[model samples]
Target: MVSDKMFTYISRRLSSIKQTPLPFGGLNIITIGDFFQLRPVKGKTAGGLMSTLMISVSTRVMLIRNICTSDGLVNGAMGLGVSLSSIQNGIPIKPIEHTFMFLGHQIVRSQFPLMPSWACTVHKVQGLSLDKAALDLGSTVFEKGMSYVALSRLRSLQGLTIIRLDPYKFECSDEVLEEYSRLRDTLSPHDDV
Candidate 1:
């Protein structure tokens, strides 16, 4: 969606063409769309945002923004179908704002921040609680604590379906154990963690 800066530009152009100093050159304007739905998006096509996300009613999505005013649907939130699309605030459809200088001109771009959570990288699911998960420990584990981050997402083994988990193939960081100990120490005055 566009901001008032767009309106100012339009008014200036109309005034110049019509040779009138009045706003929009005294042109009669009729604005449509609900106010909540009208707030300008960061970088997305105002009305044509659906085309960018290519989302369907069935597309499961994650809410990347923390819309605190919504129904517990804030950043790092995920939901299904109509629940996502019908959000009155129109968050998922909103475009992420991107700006850069190109050829001495500022270029702006907007895009939806939704992603399909049915399959996501471990980093994406961090700090989230899942009822069930399929651990796909790739052939090579590149970093320590990667396995723990992926495995700890679920509650128990009954809720997990491991696609390929060779425990020996991946090792958790020892710092993880130490950190747990540090957290359990509630009376430590020096514990900033």
Candidate 2:
């Protein structure tokens, strides 16, 4: 998986990639955000504004642990506010075997400027427009906002696809209560000490 830092440097150095020429140039596919549970790592904090958020290591580890176990448990039913960067990390560490082939590829040169044929984690594709998008909504953490980001990545919904999700296959925990309370306290409009 590529880190957010990787994108920062690569996006700038790869300016020529955009003009290299192809029906589909740059990154052709992208995975967007989800809101059922958490936001992206190094994202905004609880201020009702997306800018102040940042990724928390604890949140990252928890999401990774959930992915590693293949059991999407979040402590409780109302628990919320999970981070995407952590979940992306977890999927591979705890990947599910499939009949289809799966490969991990990385763009080292930062000059090729091509949409990778292999699987890429969500963090790599944010803010990028794509010709096609295949979202892996495998866990219970699936939320509308996440879906929105993924679906809207493309100029149109022509090549958008949502993988099938199993309703009876996942579990949730109450740990999210802490997150909700924290966010509420931080972002609440009315406050006084």
Candidate 3:
């Protein structure tokens, strides 16, 4: 993850290049994935297990907890929000009434164990197998294997939409290649054979 200090440095660099004021210099920038990434997602709060959730009716959500595993409400399970009750406090920590029906079964709960799953950064989807994904590796990738990590998350190509594919985005580091070559040399068959 990019640290806040590093991000500030990048902003200053961009400002310097554009000859504008400090901090991005109000330059128009396009993100690789979605518009939601225009703003950084909030870090975990006091709960530490979950962040502040925002949802509405018909919103797609992923179960963050194994609240009702037997009924298929395990972690990573996706569902739609059918209803949302009043907020327990001024904050959205816990909803007073929450209900959703999946597989023809209606489940009601006072506290929800759900999170919005429509979009996320590439780093957030590293180990997750998502049903759908959109990748635009056009000059936005900076780390090695970033393309592979993004492309491998989808279950199939049917759910993937590649807005752009820059071949240069799939570069491997020189140190990695050197180590791979050393390993291959060690595994080579003996000449005496």
Candidate 4:
């Protein structure tokens, strides 16, 4: 999850380079993320070229004790908001509350649920497989093995989609390519031992 602070920083950098104001004053930039995983806690944000969301509960919840022990929704266990009601009270706002059900028990609590979506860093995605992935390889990549790690997350080529892939992003150094060629030749059936 990209924190408001980090987002602002990136937007400023981009605006400086483009010499024009970015949309939303550089806010609300849409990016890809691993949405199925857990979100970050409120206030503390994550996501950048090298950062990932730090999972934490930003909201406080009253866990209505329930009989179900299998799901870990026991008494005092924190629960996430599946739905939220409008705030009311100070600031002419109602108190923020999140509603969730645990083993038929209704739990309501107040806290920031954080952003609904975020882009995860490549390092955070290791060992996980995705059915489909949209990779945004902007103009330049900073680290080695980043391309490999991103592409390997998907099970197959059919599941991979590259966005804004600079041609230079795929280029390899001569030594690396020569080593790869040698390895390929060894695997070729026509090659003599």
C-alpha positional error of residue 145 in candidate 2 after TM-score superposition, expressed in Å: 2.6
> What does each candidate score in C-alpha RMSD?
20.1, 22.3, 16.9, 19.8
* lDDT, candidates in the order shown: 0.60, 0.39, 0.60, 0.47
Q: Candidate 2: which stretches are off by over 4 Å?
A: 1-39, 42-117, 140-144, 166-193
Query: Higher-TM-score candidate among 3 and 4?
Result: 3
- Model 4 RMSD in angstroms: 19.8
Candidate 4 per-residue C-alpha lDDT over 1-193 given as tens digits, one digit per residue, 9 for 90 to 100: 5543454466557767767554323334576743222232233111111122223333334332332457654433343433344323311112334566656888665533232223555554543677887887765454544566667778988988887686556544454455345446434476443
* lDDT of each residue in 1-193, candidate 1, tens digit only: 3334565577668879989765566677666532111222245333222335666776878766655545676656787645543676344455566566657888665657565666776665666678899888876445665677677778778899988876775664454454345335422565343
- lDDT, candidate 2, 100-173, per-residue tens: 21255432221111122244455444445678877775663353344445455676778877675544434332
Off by over 4 Å in 3: 1-52, 63-77, 84-113, 190-193
Task: Look at candidate 4 and tell me the lDDT of residue 36.
Answer: 24
Model 3 per-residue lDDT tens digits across residues 162-183: 9889998886655446544543
Residue 169 miss distance in model 3 (angstroms): 2.2
TM-score of each: 0.53, 0.27, 0.48, 0.33
Better of 1 and 3 by TM-score: 1
Worst 10 residues of 3 by lDDT: 31-40
